[model samples]
Target chain A: MTSGLDVRGITHRYGKKTALNDIGFSLDKGLFCALLGPNGAGKSTLFSILTRLFVPDAGEVMVDGHSLAREPGKALARIGVVFQQPTLDLDLTVRRNLKYFAALHGLAGKDADRRIETSLEQVNMAERAAEKVRALNGGHRRRMEIARALLHGPAVLLLDEPTVGLDAETRSSITGHVHNLASEQGLTVLWATHLVDEVRGSDHLVVLHRGKIHANGNAAEIAGDVSLQTRFLEMTGGGK
Target chain B: MKAALICLVAIVHREALRFVSQRGRFLAAIVRPLVWLIVFAAGFRAALGLSIQPPYQTYITYEIYIVPGLCGMIQLFSGMQSSLSLVYDREMGSMRLLLTSPIPRWWLLFCKLFASTAISIFQVYTFLAIAALTGIGFSPAGYLAILPALIVNGLMLGALGLLLSSTIRQLENFAGVMNFVIFPMFFLSTALYPLWKMAEASTILRDICAFNPFSHGVELIRFALYGQVDWMALLWVLLAFAIFLSGSLWGYDPSRSMVRRKA
Candidate 1:
């Protein structure tokens, strides 16, 4: 069976400055992968490439076995993305936003409505679907965005810093919801973050620093006796 | 084909909702031109008496003369407003959502242009309706005829806006650039006066106005409002649309985007 995501030789540069260098990784179906990195560790750049917002200088991104370079539409259809920055139209209702996204993926009529309800239910935001995005607090807005991203039933879900700026309680809830999505819905997940606490011992982790992966394994196995936070700091050379 | 249609309708519906939600924008789109019509045009009525132009078979009032220009103004502003929203969308990250859709980028951008143009048409008719109620009336058939003309002109200006929005680096720079564009395009064209009147001022200015693609858009609407067809004007507008569309498509090319360069 084809891997959920197969990235190979992903290298990108901004003029003379290299942002990502020959980075490669693969995530299997239903596995949750944490792309752990610091603020300037090229996490966002990699997410941009994965989302096809920016084409990497050299790389191959395959979503469900469809090559992004050759079949961008097909590849994109297989992967749902939530950007680090909020993407909801603030003036639109939560349901309106989801419906619009569903239509973009060619879902409509009762099918779109059904998926909208299901995804919102998954995020536990079904009751707030009629509220305008601006009326919702930041946490609810983030939940609505996540719900919108899942309406198409993508094989892979890519989120770039989805928990930024949220309160601790909200952040943990969103993280828990996504983790449950991977296990319960059998969805592939690649979540990029600078927050180490968000990673679980059982989850696969790829530590990235200065455009290169420093470690890749089960979080618990790699960290061993130390906490994942301390291990991440040590791997990135920021340890005390 | 079905997917394309669904995408178009969804985008158009979103644009419509945005337009309605922003009542201030609707008010401004109308008031800017109405001020020119009721105040500026009223003041200039005696100063600039229009003679028998091709589009105007007899001596016409200045209000009548500037109606097409006002329609063009509505579309032009609406187009630029659409451009402003796009820049905002890019900053706020909603543009990424739109860009990541499985539908092709070119088609999506075209849908955006279509949606804005569709909204501009509604605003133009609303202005015309107000004018009609305020003792400035035209042929009802002429009103129907101007629909296609307004669309062609709308597409031209909206395409120009798309090109500018894609190329512009920041939202702060957009307002000044819009002023530079809107005032020049409005003043230097045959929008307020006939080209012959421009020729009366200076040969150089006349030539400049003659070369302005916006002049052709105004003239196309002017002729259409009179139930006449100006093939030259129509051709010029279409050509401008083609050039601007191509330029915008290139400007929005992912490889050429500012984010890629800044990264």
Candidate 2:
């Protein structure tokens, strides 16, 4: 069976500097994979490749059985993305933002409305749908973004450093919410972040550092006798 | 095909919605042209005596002569404004939402061009209406004929904006666009003065204005406003549109360094 997300021999470079070096990984369905890496660890580059925003110099990405390079439209249709930066229009209402995204994916009219309602309900932002994004707090705006990403009902979700800049409590809540999405909805998720605390012992773990994958396995197994935090630090050389 | 059409409508609707919310943009678009038609034209009327031009069968006042040019100016600025917004979207990350869509990238870009062109057309009509009320009017049929010309010219200018946005990485650098692009394009074109008038000044300057695609665009609008077709101008504007659009697509290609360099 095809995996939810599969990358092989993926490589990218910026001038003479290598950003991602022969990175390869795979995740099964209903799994919350934490792509733990420090700043400039190539997590964002990898995410960009997966999202088809930047084509790799040499690599292949398979999203739900479709090859991204050869069949980008079909592969892209199967995935949703939440970028490291906020992407919503602050002047538009939450519902309007979601609706605009829905239309980009070819969903419209009543179908778009239903999906918008369902996604908002999932994120618990249904009550704030009428409020402009500028009126919402940082956490709520992030939730609205997640709702916006989920509007098209993709099989795989990719979030790049999504919890950055939020308070600890809000970060934990968002993390917990995303974990529930994977476990409850059979959605495969790749959550890229530098925070070691966000990775659960049972979760899939992939450590990226300086353009390479240093570790890829269950979080507990990768940590072995030590804590995941120590293991992450050791692997990334304190993420310097 | 159906999905593509739906995407097109959504993009256009969103642009229109944004246009409505930004009331200042609409006001500025209308006011800028009026300032020229009412104030600048009044000052230049006596200085620049007008002979019957192709589009003008009889002697006309300076205000009437520059009306088509003012229409072109509206689209030119509207196109650049749209470009500024695109740059803002890129820096602000909203463009990621657009580029990641399942729809073809070319189609998405085209939808944006179409939407901006639509807005430009709307602004042009608003200006023309106010001008008509002020006693500077064209053939009733000429008003209708100008629609197609406006679309072509708007697309050409909007495509130029798209090309610029794809290459410009930061919002701060966008100020240079107004200086290098907007001012030169507006002033060098036949928008403010006819090419013959420029010829009277200097052959080289007239030649430069003649070669400027924006000049052809103004000529197209001018002829169409009088129920005439300038075949050469139409072809020149279309050629410029195609070149600019293709360049933008190349610039936006995922394999290229434009998007990657920004990231």
TM-score of every prediction relative to native? 0.97, 0.98
Report lDDT (Cα) of residue B159, candidate 1. 96
Worst 10 residues of 1 chain A by lDDT: A231-240
Model 1 per-residue lDDT tens digits across residues B227-253: 999999999999999999999998777
Top of the candidates by lDDT: 2
lDDT of 2 by residue, B1-263 (tens): 88898889989999999999999999999999999999999999989998887978898899988998899999999999999999998888888889999899999999999999999999999999999999898888999999999999999999999999998888898889999998998899898888899999999989999999999999999999888999999999999999999999998898884888735
Every model's DockQ, to 2 decimals?
0.75, 0.79
Best by DockQ: 2
Provide the RMSD of all predictions against the true structure, rounded to 1 decimal.
1.4, 1.0
Name every residue pair that clashes in candidate 2.
none
lDDT of 2 by residue, A116-175 (tens): 999999888889989999999989988888888888889999999999899999999999
Error of 1 at B239 (Å): 0.8
